[model samples]
Target: MMLETGKIRENHKAALPYYYRMVIEVPEHFQALPGQFLQIQIESKTTDPLLRRPFSIAGLSRNRVTVFYQVKGKGTILLSRLQAGDSISLLGPLGKPYPAVPGPKIILAGGLGAAGLLFLAKNLSLGSQNKKSVVLLGCKTKEDLFLLDNFQDLGIPTYCATEDGSFGFKGLATSLLTQKIKKIPGKGTLYACGPNPMLAMAGKIAAKHGWSAYFSMETMMACGIGLCRGCAVATINGYRLACVDGPVFPAEEIIWGKLPPHPPLSPKGRGLK
Candidate 1:
């Protein structure tokens, strides 16, 4: 819940063609955990793009937080044009973090989802003496991949899968996971962050193996806080706010089907709540 002005010390293209990395300099005491995110205002004074964009913290240093993003729209396009020495408003370290689960740990990442999971991998490797933790990365093609070396540098066994057979495994990332999880020996938890479809698949796989899992969901969020109610996600307990309740949730907590279409408005023009 801290709102601070951070200087953009670095904004450059990453290994992937479309992805870019931005490094912001924060105060000394501002600490952020893995799986938490920052809400950034692209422009300092203008009100044009009214909402701040949410980006998961990819990596953290002494006083710098790094975020990896793709220039998908006008806001991000504008963000890409900014150079070093610029300043942006950042609101962050929000939402609950991924749970610290025991036993052997596995991380599954899809596409750009690797950005956040990288932080999680780093934390787990440093905190544990057991070196069995592994990272599974999946992408559409080899060109779509990034950060492979970074993960390997951490001394964790990292595997990759590509849909086109242009990389490690010839099928979906889950295929790699399926083959690997069997060798884990005992009960283990999986932490995943990716597209809804991929998360759903991983959830199903985790269930099939009787393992607990957590998923980091991606959605359109307006306010970083719960005030906007813009990021509601359907759960068994009813709708939950993604910004506050989670960008991360237990895999079993969500109702994975496409939400039923809302009812039509009444003749008086009042819509269903």
Candidate 2:
């Protein structure tokens, strides 16, 4: 991993629900992959917040890296105020990336989880000539949904679920996944990223159908690297560090019930901001 200071080219609200996408100009020599994350210090020269914030690489182009985030806490609130030409420190391209397994891929995402997984879909598409993929997204309402247009731009069929029936399906997105799984010719791979509860439900569904699934676990992390074990997650093999070992792992490896239901890291009307 490398520590570099990138200039902020843009930091603007790109969708509904007040989500912001920040674009940074990284060194031309730097490279990253889908699912890889970076630890960013909202204020490069301050100890107020102390810790660096971890964010997934939402998109990358040449030397430009995009991070999708929301003004959730004091740190993010500070980050959101940054404008064009500002600079931020980045230590990244960390964590294990999603495997590039060949198959018809089905991506399951809840709320802003789409931020990271979108890069995975893009990489897989570029790497394989015929990697058919689809995305199923879930949110509380239509306004909570984001990235639908981006997915469609990639030619990947997108289905959505909103709790208030303000969108495509009436129930949870996992219900749509269940219906889709039945129509597949054979076992397909599932990649999911979202809140613990949604992922837990997705894991159970994938297991029930005998489909292989990889999950991106979301947790409060003190350190983006493994030096601090604050982000340890229970698995069948034992406790694994979400910062280094994962942030991504097979669905079967997770001990779902042991994880409590928690709200997403993004701003969701919580007092975090």
Candidate 3:
């Protein structure tokens, strides 16, 4: 489904102001994963944010592609007014990504889930060039911090939570992932994406210890690819298709409040068909 058909080469706002970011390009083998997402087409087809928004894919160069919005309503305030070359219309490197293993890892983001964890923390700090690899961001204040200095300039190792605690671990970055899940390294691995009560408290603390998590569901999409169905993500072995099977699953296959209800879609609505 990769069509990025790009244009808009720059657009910004972050450090809050309802968050925003653009930088499109598309074409050049267009490869973007890490909790994949894309599905623009801001308006037209009789306007009014007309269906097609789903962003996240927040950093990638060479041919570009970076869309990270959160202006929330009126289709992201009509996509923060759009600019730079304009054009726009994408589909995506779509769903299913985020799966890289090594040693120490943990990237849990909240609040526009740090724009799909800024290209998944720059692809795990450029494939473990090692900097102690860690990134846990949460926001409720402190300018709703975005990109924490671009994942600390790729050396990763970032942590910030705020709920009036004003900054760095005031509370709930899953409570510093319960003190760094007892010092990580159960072969470390727990990638999250945020909201849905912080992926249900990081899937209840990575299912009480047996780690290896990965949950990037922000749902509520509109054809980010998979012919729409308006973003549905219910697991328990019945419904799965968050923009094509997943916006990244496996936080123990998520079935948290006993989910159920999804199936049958056609007009790009019902949650990523």
Task: Evaluate all candidate structures by whole-model CA lDDT and list the values in order.
Answer: 0.84, 0.84, 0.74
lDDT of 1 by residue, 40-72 (tens): 898887986888999999889899999998767
> What CA root-mean-square deviation does each model show from the true structure?
7.1, 1.9, 16.3
RMSD in angstroms between candidate 2 and the native structure over all alpha carbons: 1.9
Put down candidate 3 lDDT per residue, 1-273, tens digits, no spaces: 656568888887764456677788778888776788787878644577677777778887898877767564566677677788878878777788888777777788876677887787787777643565678888777777766888788877788889888878797789888788778656577888877766777888877887788887767776566665766676877677788888888877777664432222121331210
Which is better, 1 or 3, measured by lDDT?
A: 1
Runs of candidate 2 with Cα error greater than 4 angstroms are 127-131, 264-273
Which candidate model has the greater TM-score, 1 or 3? Answer: 1
| Model 2's TM-score against the true structure | 0.95
Q: Which pairs, if any, clash in model 2?
A: none
Ranked by lDDT, the better of candidates 1 and 2 is 2
Give the per-residue lDDT of model 2 (tens digit) for 110-227. 8878989889877766655224677888888887777888776776778898888999998988888888877766777899998888898888888888889998887788988898
Number of clashing pairs, model 1? 0
User: Alpha carbon lDDT of residue 236, candidate 2?
Assistant: 96
